[model samples]
Target: MRVFTVLGPSQAGKSTLVRAMAGLDKEAGQKLEAAGVVTLQPFSFMGEDWGAIEVAGGAENLAQAGPALAASDAAVVCVPADAEAAVLSAPYLRKVEEAGLPVFLFINRMDQTRDRVADVLAGLQTYCAHHLVLRQVPMREGGQVVGAVDLISERAWSYQDGKPSALVELPDGVRPREVEARGELLEALADFDDQLMEELIEDQEILVKEIYDVATRTLQHSQLIPVFLGAAEHCNGVMRLMKSLRHEAPPVEQALARLSPGGRVVAVGCMGELVKHLGKSVLLRAMNADCSSGTEMAGQAIGGLTMVAKGGNGSLAMGDLGRVVKSDHLRLGQVYLKDGARALPDWAQPRPATYRRLVTPVHQRDEARLSTALERMGEIDPAMEVTQDEATGHALLNLQGPQHLRRVIQTLKAEFGVEVTEDMVPPALRETITKPVEIHHRHRKQSGGAGQFADVVIAIKPLPRGSGVTFDDCVKGGAVPRNYIPSVEAGAREALMQGTNGHPVVDVAITLKDGKHHSVDSSDYAFRMAGKAAVREALGEAGLVLLQPIVKVAIHVPSVFSGNLVPMVSGMKGQILGFEAEQDAAGWDLFETLLPMAAQDELCSALASATRGTAWFQSGFDHYEEARRGDFGAK
Candidate 1:
């Protein structure tokens, strides 16, 4: 059996195409409505069994598709017929190329479009690293694409509603177009074949079997991409696509060589864990060898194997996916061998979290339950991060985007039975002193038995940004006891934790100039009190300023939309560093900038709107800079 993953943007008919190929057209509509994760289905075509893994699409869910992509033998990229949707396939195409997986570009929903196939291919070619060769030319009737003429076989077919297309005579009007497309396909193949190049130059007729061999070889090597057209909703061109995959897609052994070199047994964890009535089943794919009950992989015995297909009979075979019901040690994206486990080098990694929100249990008593559920959620979706603020001690959930957050919240309530409230994350503001000041203070306590007395004079000075707090003792002649001087420094550092504006103080230095201590009443506690009081008084006279976190950002978008990013960044009070055309990704731009941390979410939203959800960015903490009082509503 062979495995292929279906990937594309959300609402691009990826699930519909999978169902169509699986001979489940009736369930296609129903499945699409609830499909938001990777789903596996098995089917046989032309006496060969195959598995179709449909990866959830969209920017929010793309990171979650990593495991499926890592384990598949080939990729079937479903693309909408519209030219505008071509850019949406950039990230997926990049991933496929990186994996070196053979790809079949299925331009779905062809029946609903009047655009030329060449136009759609042109748009997609800009983002694809491999040469795109159209395998079929649209056969239109009455201004509608009724079917397509296969360039290789020189056969024509008319699509039937929800059934296999009927073979028809080649139309005279389409013959010229088909010939030109076939020539283009041959030309692409000729680039890598001297014989084919010579044959084409000499006007020699090329054999169909030779063309097939070249197509398969080039595709497996990730040098050429074959394009097919269809509307999977009506089963148009579905059979043809399947037949092509059955012949051109690489086999299990080839995939093993490419994915796990020199390994005879390899299994990759996929989709995390699936909770069943029996137990928690870890979804995995057999990449090199068959696995069954009692099989030892990575030193853990496989309790049982349940194949993810109709009437599978609970057996796992090479190139197929199944559930390992008894393994407790496996994790998503882990590659297990007969003796040990290793990471899949080609596995896709989730993007960094850009949006965050504070989460709290509604009843306050389910805090522990929420924590456990979030841990489980993390195991399922590694892209999400759960953290706590050290200052505020508030639990926060970081996610890919707003949509990802919503889905996570929904899962928490529906699956984990944890109802939680969410709020905006508070800014991590800080304070810094403006100048130097000196102050003196005396600590005195009068009790019936013992009295405390201590005196200290300290100087506070501003330092450069990011310098943090520094402590120095300039006292001479033991004016302050050596043991008590350490206490004074400790107290001063603790006092800096909360400045006059209720934020941590940074980038300042404290010096203990002189102090007096009594022989009996003076103690660490007394000296500490004096140090705290003196530092507080000095800060009051030195003046304070608010500092907000700034982040370095790299924004990726199509070159056409690069102009919009300038105004977008400026609107958020960000500084643009530079921008240049991205290497290897034609027609795309990478913009580097410095943006305020508080505006990160807004930037994501704006880029999505300006680029039609085709933009993505990464950011990390840069440094703290002075913030305007009005910007943060701080007095």
Candidate 2:
């Protein structure tokens, strides 16, 4: 039994489709009588059949049902003929693509369109490029979508009011145009079957088994995305889609190809050996195995999982076919790094670097627990480094990007109960003298314990950019005792590491040309104190400038929306880099530019809302530059 996600825009007739496929009445059972929420209306077929699974609708309901929706195995993307509905439907499709989930798209309400099935098929050719593959040619009756001819099985099912009617031979309307469409889908599937291609080129009818096997492999590799016809409102063409899924959905063995090159189909590994994360309750994670080559799903046992809850996402143990699930939503999969992918035994892959100046913890008191739990996260993804930042107390966890962050955070809360809080860290600033200065300092003290005295004359000069700080022992005849020289160096280094603006100081050379030390009373401690005194005096007289961080951001927005976003970024102190036109990848213009880091916060949500969540972007830290001199905020 394969799990498939049913994704589409809100009210694209997904609920109605589920009812029709489940053999339930749309008007009466549309709400799924047993289940209060109609979103995840699981329709289980024959008690013994490795049946087809249908789950949930998209939109307000979909977002709230995230945990349940992600648990699906494959997806059925529904696109209504309505323009606004289709435009909003892209987000759901993009998510399925991002998850690498195998999906079959249903072009709903095709009977409402002006053109016939052939024109729609031709236009869909360039719609998603390689991401889409049409599997069934839409069957038309009197200008209405009455049924579909399965390109793979060559089986046609004519429907009336949502039910499959008597089976018929391939119809005349699709004969000429489908000769090419069906051949194309089969040809793409042929790489998985040489004999299938041979029979096709020779003009010989290919057997159903050959076509099914090839199509399964193609769907598993995401090379062919089947498009079916449906009109849930009218109860049209739903049952035919259901029957096709029973024979079409790829077996577990084929889908594993995405995880690795063909490896041996081994026996399923034993459970309980894995380290299950303990939250309020224990949560187990398991991996999928190649069970298609005759492994009986009935042989698997659900031992020791005695206390079953009302509902939970994990193993789907129905007699023999046992599958591991991570979330209630079937679109998501278990996150894993290929073995031996990173250097550190704990590190699974090279973690991505972090350019954010400050990282705020997402929840309170989460620093310690999150650190312990995420140590393995860095191992699986070498690009991450999880720890605490001493300066700001931020749980400094570096990651690849926003997607990686979302996944980790979800797993942490749902699996570990680590409520995190974020405290954004402000970027470090630099203060360098705009002009050179010479300074002198003297200290004298007399007390009952002992008399103490020290004096120094130092010149601080700004070096060419990149010429680091340097100090010379120019005192004549031990003007400053050898024992005290290190102390002076220590004091100067500390001052440089912490500048007047509470940032690191750079690009300066200090010369200790003259200094006197009391032979009896002078110590390294006194000299160290004097060096600290000298730097403070020198920097005060030397004019200084503050440097700020710069970052590069690529924004995707419609051309009409760019007119608004461009000025928004500019107002945030960004420099417009350039722009280019694109198609589906970026609905409109791709805006690329460099901007200050301080302006980036909340930009993601802003962009998403601006484009109704259609836009995407890549932002990176570039370098540091002097901030524009003026009032910090409103004058």
Candidate 3:
């Protein structure tokens, strides 16, 4: 079965287009219709079984559509005929192109507008990497879009209200425009074919058969996009779309080639996992090779296999999405073969955790259950990060944003029956010494039979930031026994784990200068005690400094918001390193700076709000820097 993903901005009639094309609903013209956010529905046209994934619009749900895009054979990007609304397709188009999938541009809601087709096409050109060849030009009557001229067949069709388009003669004064558009289409195809270029350059006639072949080859390779238009709500031009797809859409083998090389059968994504009284089942799509119902793969029975089509319950074959039950080792996104297997490359890398929250189970007894549920969820989503902060003893959940975390929290309650509360994570702190100090400590004990006695003099000094704790033995002439020296260093290191400020001590150097050990009484235990006491005493005298982590941050956003960038960064006490034009992405800019970890929460919230959720950022821990007196009560 061939799977085509339908993508568009919110309210762009993507769901309507899918319904009309699939012959699901036909009467609801010119009204907003809400459908499933994500679903796979199979339809038939000319005895060919096909499926369409209708992805809900809006930026919030964009990340959720990754699975649909990865599983599809090709994609249809829907956009409105309005010039301004067409720009929303840029980001989505970039993703489809990156996946190496064949793309077809469908301009929806064309009947609502007239005489602005060229302007809308120009706006879309700024974003598309492939050349867009106009397959049809709009036909207007009484200043209303009534029909379109098909460039390839040199035929004109007029739309009847609520019915299939009827073929009509080329309208008067339309031949000049039709010839121009056809010429443009031929020129684009010629760029990839030498013979075609020669023929077009010499003003020679080209056969329709040759033209169709070149167009098919160019589109299959994703070098060019053939643009189609229709107002999907009226069902007008839907049949034409189905016809084009049947005749021109790249075959499933092309999708398999882009997914993996070689003749081996493979599976990339898990549509879902199900648990029943019988066993657990994993649904997956098989590519390039077929597996029968009784076949075994990776040591598991390929049972319960069925093609994802109209009432499909047959054995899975090449280019079919199906499922198998009771495979404990199977996982989503794992490539399966008859023997061993490997993992498929991720469609999109998990974005760095820009948002963090502290999660605690409300029932207290459900903590373990919550943790297990989070791990299972992470295995499926891969984008949600769950980690326990050893320093603060809080479970931190790292996700893309507030919306993402909200969904995770909801899943915890709905799926696992584990209730949890989320709050802002506090900044992690560190402690360091600011000055050097010298001290002498003696450990002594007497209990009649034996006594413990040890004396040591040590010097504590500060090292450069980021330099961890180090120990130096400067004892001369065997001032202290060598056997007991290791105990002294171990004691000092243990004390560094918890500093005077209740945080890990770092970037400090300790030197053991001189010490005394009695042969009869002195032992490793005595020396260790003396060492610990010495470091503790010296730390009290040394000036303690609280440190805060700084992060290197980069924000990628549209250049139109450049003016607000500086003020936002400066308000968070972040140092801006200036911004420049972003390469490859037009009208975008990259802002760079160093920001304290304490400012991350505020910065993330503000940037998302200001940019209407379009901007995104990445941050990494840079180094520990001294904190101000009022920043976190350091003094």
Top-lDDT structure, candidate number: 1
Query: Where does model 2 exceed 4 Å of error?
Result: 5-43, 47-102, 108-131, 137-213, 231-238, 255-257, 260-391, 394-428, 451-453, 461-477, 496-513, 554-571, 576-592, 609-611, 630-635
Q: After superposition, how far is residue 210 of candidate 2 from its true place, in Å?
A: 4.9
Clashing pairs in 3: none
lDDT of 1 at 287: 78
User: All models: lDDT?
Assistant: 0.82, 0.54, 0.77
Ranking by lDDT: 1, 3, 2
TM-score of each: 0.94, 0.66, 0.89
Per-residue accuracy of model 2 over 1-635 as CA lDDT, tens digit each: 44455657655677666656666322222221201122333344543222222333422223222222233346687777554444465556545554465677887776676566555554444334344556667776666666667776677766666445547888777787577877777777775678877887898977777777776666666666777776776666666566566666655544334333343222221111113452111121122442222223223322222212123323333212232322121111122222211111111122223323234336657656676666544322333456666656666765533544555666566555675544455555555666777767776677767666667777788876546678866778878877777787787677777666776777788877778988766767677778878877888788666666677888755554666677667777789998886554423578898977766655554665666654556678777666676613211
Model 1 residue 325 distance off true place after TM-score fit, in angstroms: 2.9
lDDT (10s digit) by residue, model 1, range 1-635: 67788999888998788888988333211121111566777676666666777877877777766777777778999989988778888877776776778999999999998777888999898888788899999999898999899988899999999988999999999999988888888999999999999999999988999999998889888889999999999999998898888888888777778656776557877666435344345667787777777778887777777666444446577777677666766666567888877666644677667788888888788889888878766765667889986766767888888888888778778777788888877778899999999898999999777788899999999999888899999889999989999899988988898998899999999999998999989999999889988888888899898999999999878887889899999999999998999996766899999998999878878988988777789999889999976869766
- Cα shift from native, residue 387, model 1 (Å): 1.9
Task: Name the better of 1 and 2 by lDDT.
Answer: 1
Q: Give candidate 2's whole-model lDDT.
A: 0.54
Q: Output the lDDT of residue 593, model 3.
A: 90
